[model samples]
Target chain A: MTWEIFNAIGTIAFAISGAIVALEEEYDILGVYVLGMVTAFGGGAIRNLLIGVPVSALWDQGLLFLMAILVITVVFLFPLRALKQWKRWGTFTDAIGLSTFAILGALYAAEMNHPLSATIIAALLTGSGGGMLRDVLAGRKPVVLREDIYGLWAMLAGLLIGVGAVNQTWGLYVLFVAIVILRMMTVHYKWRLPHRTIKQQEDVSV
Target chain B: MTWEIFNAIGTIAFAISGAIVALEEEYDILGVYVLGMVTAFGGGAIRNLLIGVPVSALWDQGLLFLMAILVITVVFLFPLRALKQWKRWGTFTDAIGLSTFAILGALYAAEMNHPLSATIIAALLTGSGGGMLRDVLAGRKPVVLREDIYGLWAMLAGLLIGVGAVNQTWGLYVLFVAIVILRMMTVHYKWRLPHRTIKQQEDVSV
Candidate 1:
């Protein structure tokens, strides 16, 4: 029950986020839908692929797909001024989505008896993977890899779950809320990971 | 038997192409290996995920993994002058890889009794998926979507197989050679698809 609720929230938030990005990129209607779907499901698809789940199983979530599409379509049709305001709300919802997805992923991996490392990886990928794909498809740097302290919070959630500190239902909810707060605080504070770039003469062509 | 041969050729070429791109992006040694592995295996992984194969089945190809890693290591260690020379040859090898991987994907889908459209999609994804992933991870536009006549040839190969025009082993061999030639010719001639971009005042930030 908790899992289903979390999944629905994450899916809707991600769908809206994806639609926003697609519109920002000036993608057509079809591109908007495709990008929206990718953002909503890309993380779970990648997590399933890595965790030995049948990727086609994603199709089983018929209601989730409908809900996500509805959210995306609504976002796409909203007026420009409304969208601008929604962007402010978007960060909070995005934090909610990220936290729920990460904890859920770690929970799934832990239930499957995967090692702590695998659980951590699952959490990180599930939390950030959709956003990463969204950014990449939009032709931008993956925010998780280079930007703020985003992935670290996901890792921390995974670690807590893996170490058996958050095995209860209320514990998961507590972790979820804590992570959302941490992510939003980091965003507000503009927290960033340590940066490094190798300075060298480089060919920019691929 | 034929599939194994084609897989080997494709893996080596893609590994080299991936290493070249990673080096061009100025990534460290670890990035080169990760990108190389992703370039070599990402297509098959994506295809398998879409077509209901167990994604983890990719791990069964231990020999192929070793071969891909070895090729990447060699490319990394090559002197700058030698690397430049390899770039000239890289196009030809890449064409070969694309042709082989595309045909193999189509064959797999066809043998499974999938629809013609699915077969074509499989071929296109298998041929171009790795390169797309590499480019995205390196923070560039997917070359397959924007650049050349790359995906068309894969679709063509898939169409021929789907329609039963290339069922025989010899027919497949002929088709492979024809695709390689066509792809190389297009690269030589610089063919491009029709494109239109919507001009608008758009938010570039995602």
Candidate 2:
């Protein structure tokens, strides 16, 4: 996917997830829009902060605020049509968002000339940090800290981008394709690191 | 007051308020620190956002985070000493914070060349918005929106700063003195806006 296309997908996917979480929390109209915008844009802000970028929320405030309100209004009116019903859609969007954030973060880190490890770390953070914060805000355990197929997807994308930086020619599509496929397959089967007998019993308790 | 001194007062005042709110809510240690920092710095962040200033939170993250943790630690260690047992002090610090934030917000806006009304609005928001959010997070009625001397002091400071800007010789101290004195006296005297009287209340209810 082109950077712009994938970026759009990332924003919408994150917004949908945020809406779902807000709905589960029983937020009001304003609260739903706020969570949606916050979950979509919050990771970017944190990434910019880490890279010491200047403030950029200086968008035409009217336009963005209007857009956020509009999205909420439409969702309220037609909640079913506002989001897809297919299970695969969720998996697809999640994968797309993960890859998009990871690459964006890696590129930003490179622009900041961080070391490889730092770049990888930042990329992974940018990729999954929003979901982590969203879960925390929604009063659920952070998906990143759970014993499942997570963080590693972002890590893989970051590693790909970090190594590809040496060659400096892998198009954005290449990274997106690799990350989406790997992530979907892992999450599809609930693939995760092994747990010992004690850990298994603890999981049952939880 | 110098920026340093005003900032210090804001830091300690807001931190104390946050901790008290957190304790009242029975938050965990980590939750307490996080709430404390947000309560302290959230207003300034909103102020910077409205005026396109680089938020102090971006540059002062380390110091702010460290101060939050330290304040929480101190509060935990010496509850009596840390939280000065002055019911009047509660009224006092809260008022001072409101006034100072208003002044600070106005100054930043004037620097950004926003219109006078917008400047005043931003000032009012900066003074009370963070506290409002803090109260919401803690599940209490916002003091600013209730029957109190809270938002009035902010308005008073805004008026002083707005008039000073007309003269074009307003320094930090001039604004500081006007804000602090008005707020302090308002609290000491228990000044408040007129509220619903018995007849008026009955009429409204009917």
Candidate 3:
């Protein structure tokens, strides 16, 4: 029951986020739905493919698909002026969705007896893969790769799971909350991942 | 034997193409290899995921991976002045890879008894999907989506296979050559798919 609830929340949040990006990019209605569905399911699909899950298994989540579609439609229909108020909420919900999906991915990989590295990879992909796809489709730089410590939170969740530190139901819940809080803190503090330009290196050599 | 040969052609050509793009974007050596690998295998991986092929099957082709890596390394080490001469050939080789992969994708889907729509989709994805992934990772618009009639040839190949119009070995070769020629002609003539900007539509409405 908890799993289903968390999944639903993540799906709805991702769908809304995708819809917002599509709107910002001025995509057509079809593009809006396409992006929304991709954002909600693309990460899981990518993870499943990598972890040897049957791709057809994706089709079984009919309810989640419907929920995502409904959420995206509502977001699309909401007044533009009113939608501006939800911008801050979008970040909060996105953080929740990211942490939830990351933990779930780690748990799933662990249950499959995958190695620790695979578990961590699964978590990172499931947590940020959808956003990467969205940014790619929208022709923007992937924020997760270039911005704050977003993927680190997912890796942390994966490490916690792989080490058997968050096995119990209460423990999983606690981990979820902790990840969300940490992600939000990074955002609040404007944390950034270190990056260096090749151009700078070339200039130094010259 | 023929199938393996075509796969090699596609993989090598794609790797070089990807490496060139990475160099153009001034990525580090690691980025070049990552992009090269993604461009070579991304389309096939995506097609496998969508068509119920076990994605782990991708790892079995150790030789192909090695070949791609070698090709990328060679391209990376080549003289930059000499590399400029191959720009025209890049288009030719890319066309070959695109057509070869598209036909192969269509045949795979048809052999699996997928519907014509799925076969066409598979072909399109397999042909252009890698390039799309490359462009997205490079933080640029996907040329496949924005320019030319690139995907049409893939769809046509899928349609031919799905309809059993090109079942013989000789017929498949003929179809492949025809697709390459058609794609080349489209490029030579600068043919473009029809597109409309939302800004133009909004301007008209106002």
Candidate 4:
């Protein structure tokens, strides 16, 4: 099914991205695999929990697990210099993964009769949760919380689906494409959410 | 009834600890409250997911939310200098929270007929998951992953409970107390998990 294909693509994409981050962070082999697996599955796990899906169900995705492992292994086996374009590849795949997963998460929640808020939350988590976990484990701030308008697009996609504005299969595909394009555009333009920072002196007093 | 009481204690303790960390990190008021709530409930949310509990069930604990908020507010109201002993207080409360939550998580998973692996995972996550999340949100490595003998006691407690070596109310209480004492002793003695670090030079080739 199309859904299965999208899921596989997202999983492979996230696993490779995670492996890259681990390598960049100079993590050992075990750490690399752990980060890769977490990045590939952490989002869906978080979303499942939010939408009342049994976390045990995660273990049922044997093929997906295998796919992620394969991707991670490939990433590790390749020389970093040979993958000089890893950054570009990572961004492209990340955009695809995020879009596909966001739509999938929203549809799953909506199908389960979750409310708009829950659906939106599910989409956001599914789209960015794994990457956030990967960054945290790498001892960095979660880019989703601080960087470009990332999670918002996922939430918007979820909102559209939850509101029944895009329920058909073709409609879902269109939405996915739109999301990916939007994400790419945002990154291209360096779009960011508004931020607030208290002065260091004032912050210390409080 | 006792379980509810223990849960409250854990919640309060974690909320306070989270608030303190947020303060130390110089995060804003919003970040402080967010971290506090995450620390108090994130673990249970994770454990529930793993054990097949509906995450929406998290919303059912209105009293817990109120308690966390109250604690965060109180923590913020106190002057930082006045709370100079916060590190000591935080460690003591964290130990209590960790032990109680670990036991509770293991018990919940065991009662659900989960396997030993799931039970132990639940226990570890319940005990340290929130703290890990808080640290990540604060942009620090998880203390549970890096510091002394923290998660081991939780795993041991879970292992005991999972194997039915300790199941009765009295047995559970004993296990909880033992974990707390062991944790405190480890901290006092500066005990740590055996660590291995590959040289940066060696890590790059792989």
Candidate 5:
């Protein structure tokens, strides 16, 4: 039950985020819908693939699909004035989505007997894969690769779960809440990961 | 025997293309190898997922992985003066890779008794999927979405194979050759699909 609720929330949150990006990119109605759906489901699909789940398993989630579509439609119909606050709210909602998905992905992999590395990879991909696809299709760099401490939290969640530190249902809930809070704090504090630059003759510039 | 040969050729071609793009993007050596491997194997991995093949199947292709890595190393080690010729021969090599992969993907899907649409999707994805992933990772727009008549040929190959018009080994070879020629001609002649533009207030410009 917790999984279902968190998954639904994540789906809606991601769909809205994707729609916002599509509109910003000047995509037409078709593009908007495509991007929205991809964002909502891309992460799960990728996670499933990584863990050996059949891609056709995605078709079984009728309710999640409906929820995502409904959310996308409502986002598109929302007033432009109300959307001015999206910058503030978007980060919060995205954090919620990322945390929920990360936990879910880690739990799923742990249940499937995947190793610790695979579980962590599943968490990171499930948390950020859709957003990366959204950015790529919109012709932008993926934020996770260069942004604040985003994927790291997902990895942490996966590690905790894989190590059996958070096994029960209540423990999962706690982990989920903790991750959301951590993600929000990271964003609010503007935490960033260290980056390295190569010092060489920059010849090819795309 | 044919499948092995075609698959190897496609892998080398795509790895080279991806390495070139990474070089052009000014990525480090690590980035070049990552992009090359993703380009060489990403599509097949995706196709396998869609057809219910275990993702672990990817790890089984040790020879292919070695081949792709070797190709990427060679591409990077090639002389700077000779690298200029990449712009000249890259298109031809990419066309060949695209055609071979498209046919191979379609044939794999059809053999699995997938629906016609799935076969077509598999073909298109297998042919262009790696390149799309490479471009996305490199932080650029996927060329298949905007390039001249690229994905259409893959779809055509899938359609023919799915419909049983190209069933025999000889027929498959003919179809593969035909697709390569068509792709080359489209590139040489600069054929492009008509694009529609939406008139809207550009809000989010990446």
Candidate 6:
């Protein structure tokens, strides 16, 4: 309902998704915890620094955040086998985290009175950067770099928030609806970019 | 040598050593280059931030520094096997970088008119911090946390610099000489603290 609430939810979503992926990679506990914590907090820290907050936000409520990451890592360690095996859910929850975070990052940019282009770019970056980093460190090609709908969902959510801001009608609820609707549609239709189906015009040289 | 000269030498020394250690960990060329970059420049970056200097010391000359790292990494990668087997030389080089950095850090604190104890501590930290971070990221136990002479040599170097400062007999050259002398002696004798060492004690307690 509130921004703080959504941020917490997004953090948990990312942490869980990170833990699931780490398990699939057969990482040790330290790797799982590291990946999970980074996934949960890295984007926020990057955003905060760009917005002139140098220290990590985790220090504000350090123990709670650590517990969130730890719990998810522990879950993926043993009892969360079903979640780890559910490839589609892993892909889908990752999308949810990505799209929602895009909205949150754009909100921070608009709050800072950044111009539309920079605001949108920051939103897009924050939403996707953590997952990209996590995948790289985990030694896998990132899903967004594939033909997945992952990044497109987040960028669309960011675009929606930017449009709302342009019309001077932006509100928190607008962001919430945008993320959920985009994520749901993406999941429902298995939607991705029209990259594969784009018109193939011959070059002028031809 | 002026402090600036010693500092420049120390930075390059650390970078070269860092590149070698990174190769020992079997990193790819890009990773090895970045590791060397961190080893060389990380100390001064921290010191700059602490003393309120701008951060461009990292960002502005970043490409040149990166080139240094790349050159060193490429040069070291081939000869690394022979080099690693030179246990004595390896330790000596590591000690040299450590001691040089420590003395430089202490000199900086003295320049800032920091209190004696704080100055000593800062110097020791600067000397060892870069390598400690490098080792940890490379998945090695930090060398300073060993029961060996690693951190002690740096402190000894710092202490010598501090004494020179106290008696007004200090010059940058004097401090540099002290660091090199103490570091060489420590390496020659395997001059670790005995079984009652702090590292041993910490390990026991933990």
Alpha-carbon deviation at A107 in model 2, angstroms: 1.2
For A124-144, candidate 2 gives per-residue lDDT tens digits of 887777776566555556676
Model 3 residue runs over 4 Å out of place are A1-53, A57-132, A141-206, B200-206
Expressed between 0 and 1, the share of native interface contacts present in candidate 2 is 0.01
* TM-score of candidate 2 against the unseen true structure: 0.59
TM-scores across all candidates? 0.60, 0.59, 0.60, 0.62, 0.62, 0.57
TM-score quality measure for candidate 1: 0.60
Off by over 4 Å in 6: A55-58, A165-171, A196-206, B1-18, B21-35, B42-54, B57-81, B84-206
Which residue pairs in candidate 5 have backbone atoms (N, alpha carbon, C) closer than 3 angstroms, thus clashing?
none
Model 2, position A76: C-alpha lDDT score:
46
Candidate 1 A-chain TM-score? 0.96
Per-candidate chain B TM: 0.95, 0.82, 0.94, 0.95, 0.95, 0.78
Question: Per-residue lDDT for B138-206 in model 6, tens only?
Answer: 766445544345655555555655666433435555656666777777667667543211111111100
- Model 5: per-residue lDDT, tens digit, A83-141? 65677677777887898889888988999999999899999999999888888888977
Worst 10 residues of 3 chain A by lDDT: A25-34
| Predictions' DockQ, in order | 0.13, 0.06, 0.12, 0.14, 0.14, 0.06
Task: Give model 4's TM-score for chain A to 2 decimal places.
Answer: 0.94
Window of ten residues with lowest summed lDDT in model 5 chain B:
B197-206
In the range B141-195, model 3's lDDT, one tens digit per residue, is 6666556788778889988998898998899889989999998998899876543
Task: Name the lDDT value of residue B69 in candidate 3.
Answer: 94
Instruction: Judging by DockQ, tell me the better candidate of 3 and 4.
Output: 4
- Residues A159-183, candidate 1, lDDT per residue (tens digit)? 9999999999899999999999999
